[model samples]
Target: MEPLNNDMSSIPDRDALPYRDCVGIAVFNRDGNVFIGRRKGSDDPERSADFDAPWQMPQGGIDKGEDPLRAALRELYEETNITAVSLLAEAPEWIYYDLPEDMLGKALKGKYRGQRQRWFAFAFTGDDSEIDVEAPGGGKFHAEFEAWRWERLSRTPGLIVPFKREAYEKVVEAFIDIPQRFTHV
Candidate 1:
């Protein structure tokens, strides 16, 4: 295998894969409740990284030519019908996590481990009723969260995939100054 260069021109061209680098926004309300969702078909609803199902913050793909902040905003509206929320704050750079090898297809396997994700923290400025994962292009292809709720954002890091844990820890630490960080937005 050859070294992969992030440089746009040096990379060899190939068909696109669905699993790409992305930005995941962890939006919360004023009540100290961090935003979370139930994956559509997740076998385990209350899954931890060590189990079958686990709750998580809102996140999505970072399309080419899109900055992580922009991607975070786009995914916010797309997944939750959250159109007018305020950007309380954001992480400095990108956070990455990889899909399990078994979950990959012929197309997804050739590239990076999984996704290089950036997580943004926001306060929900709109009504909670506005969250509608069914709006249009939603739901995970395999695992899906069954429900959503607001919880302490500080605990999110220990819950996601092992590789993503560090990113989770870093993001929450950066945004610690925000009051309650999760609550009525």
Candidate 2:
């Protein structure tokens, strides 16, 4: 009998795989802090290590033919249950990130190599009571986060998975001035 070969080289080239189209939202509160959520770890042991740094902004796949901005709004409400928000700014360009070699064929349902994201910054205008991580999207959508909190924008990159750090850094740069704008409003 032959043993199973669990080699990565046997898989297709990761660079050749397509990136998932997605939208990321930076929901800033009146204090200028951005929202972050601790991802709910998967039951798969092979993928458990991916949650080492689970905190992330609200993000999700973009529906076919959906406008990027609308997708951002929908993802925000679905993930955080907060509808009172106003657009602050948008990243000048899409940011791309590749999954780690080990995660390439294991993550994103073994479909996407990573994500190509359009990011938006929004000023959260509702109270804290509106935020619900346990049963987001009015319980219609699967809960992606187990807990959530407001964090400093500059610190986000360090809080997310290493493979997605660069993307988070770019998002921070693109919306760096947004928080300050709310200070005087």
For lDDT, the strongest prediction is 2
lDDT by candidate, in order shown: 0.65, 0.87
lDDT of 2 by residue, 66-120 (tens): 9999999999888888899988888999999988787777778888888999999
What is candidate 1's lDDT per residue for 1-185, written digit by digit as tens?
99877786434243344347888887767675677775555333224345543557777777879888898887777666677677877777766555544444432445644666777778777787777665523453322344677767787776565545776787778777665533344
Assess candidate 2 and give its TM-score to the true structure. Answer: 0.90
After superposing all C-alphas onto the true structure, candidate 2 shows an RMSD in angstroms of: 2.5
Judged by whole-model lDDT over C-alpha atoms, candidate 2 comes out at 0.87
Q: All candidates: CA RMSD in angstroms?
A: 8.1, 2.5
Residue 103 in candidate 2 has what lDDT?
73
